[model samples]
Target: MKLGVVGKGGAGKTTVAALLAEAYVAEGRRVVAIDTDSNPNLGISMGLSLEETEAVPVLPRSMLVGVQGDVTADELIGEYGTDTPVGATLLSAIKVTEAGAGCTCGGHATVRSLLSDALADRADVTLIDMEAGLEHLSRSGGTLAHADVLLVVMEPSRKGVLTAARTLPLAEELGIPFTVGLGNKAKRPDDRRFFEDLCAEHGVPLAGVVPHDDDVVAAGRTGRCLTASSAPAVRAEIDAVIAHLDALTG
Candidate 1:
């Protein structure tokens, strides 16, 4: 199964994706987690450092205007990306980590194509940590076209709820097939109801609610997967979310 996680910035979308990937990995599944977000912190959340090679090469500016559409994926892969810069001065600016080195323009599309190609033959579960919005996927010729599920993460706030509503139409236009809303940072039963009502009013499915956990915040600061340090409550919530996703895609 291929799952795409998305939401507005600061909505805990990356956290959700990280935990979901961890869940899959722990199940003895060979999982490929692709970080297509410009922030590129999925690796960090997964307890891995950023690396230069993982950085997807940025396509040239001209290619952004559709001139490169005719080019085969292989051709684009062979011709577009560049190696990490060398030397102390360049290295300082290009600081490489296990997650990825810094990239320039059109890097998201390059990464999306690479991921699509890498997963073409494999039947392993693929989880995409998409950009905060669906724009990146939309631009890359519906990169999530094959995704069995699109998970939108939202916090318990009026703005966050509104953002989920706003994203629903975009997901529909892209033919995302299955889209569900996950309410993160819930602190109380009331918070859960708020999000559930928001989803119902917006016509989006409520996958599950994850309560606020200090461990989740601390894990992020220490660059660790929350699932690794999370309390049983947190783990249970995440498990419920994943189960819902699995059922949806089943």
Candidate 2:
């Protein structure tokens, strides 16, 4: 299954994505968690230490500019562009953590193509932690176009629900078949009902509600995966979300 996670900045999208990836890995599936957000902290959330070796080779300078509409697709994919190290270049484009001169040009299309090709090969699951909002969708040419499921993470705040509502139209335009709302960082039992009613009122599928957990906060602060923390509540919530996703895509 291919899943894309999106939300407003600081909405815990990366945390959820990392947990989802960890869940898939625990199921013995070959998973590739793509951090497509400029924040570049998804890997840190997944407990992956950033290293020079993990640096995805950069795309050719000419191809980078072409992605932003400076050139045609044919030209960008021409012989010179073909020299890009397939997955590495694509990942590097989206991998925000790498610190050389930033890719000011748009390479999201190339990133999407590479990700699609990689998924087609043999990955059991590909989870993409998309940049904060729906902007990436257009930039990447509906990279989430073929995603089996699209997950929008929200907190219990009014702003969070509003942001999810704002992103819905874009997901619809992109032809994402299934879209679900996940309530994260719920501090009170009443918040759960609030999110449920909000989802119902908004016509969004309610996947799961994850309570606010201190372990999650600690994990984030330490740049560690919450999966390894001895927090049953957090784990159970993530497992529930995974189960819902499985049932939706089954």
Q: Please tell me which predicted candidate would have the highest TM-score against the true structure.
A: 2
The TM-scores of all predictions, comma-separated, are 0.74, 0.79
Clashing pairs in 2: none
Worst 10-residue lDDT window for candidate 1 reads: 85-94
Off by over 4 Å in 1: 50-106, 111-120, 137-140
The local lDDT score (0 to 100) that residue 108 gets in candidate 1 is 50
Write one digit per residue (lDDT tens) for candidate 1, span 65-184: 123454553454345422221100000101133465444334554444444444444425667777776565556456566566788889898788777777777777777778888999
Residue-wise C-alpha lDDT for candidate 2, range 1-250, written one tens digit per residue? 8888988888899888877777677777766566666546665666545553255343343233233444443443333221111121123345444579576334565455544444444457777778887677675467677677889999898777777787678788888778888999999869999998888887777799888989889887776656634567877888899899899888
| Cα deviation of 97, candidate 1, in Å | 12
User: What TM value does model 1 have?
Assistant: 0.74
- Cα lDDT computed for each candidate against the true fold: 0.64, 0.68
lDDT of 1 at 172: 78
Off by over 4 Å in 2: 50-92, 95-105, 115-117
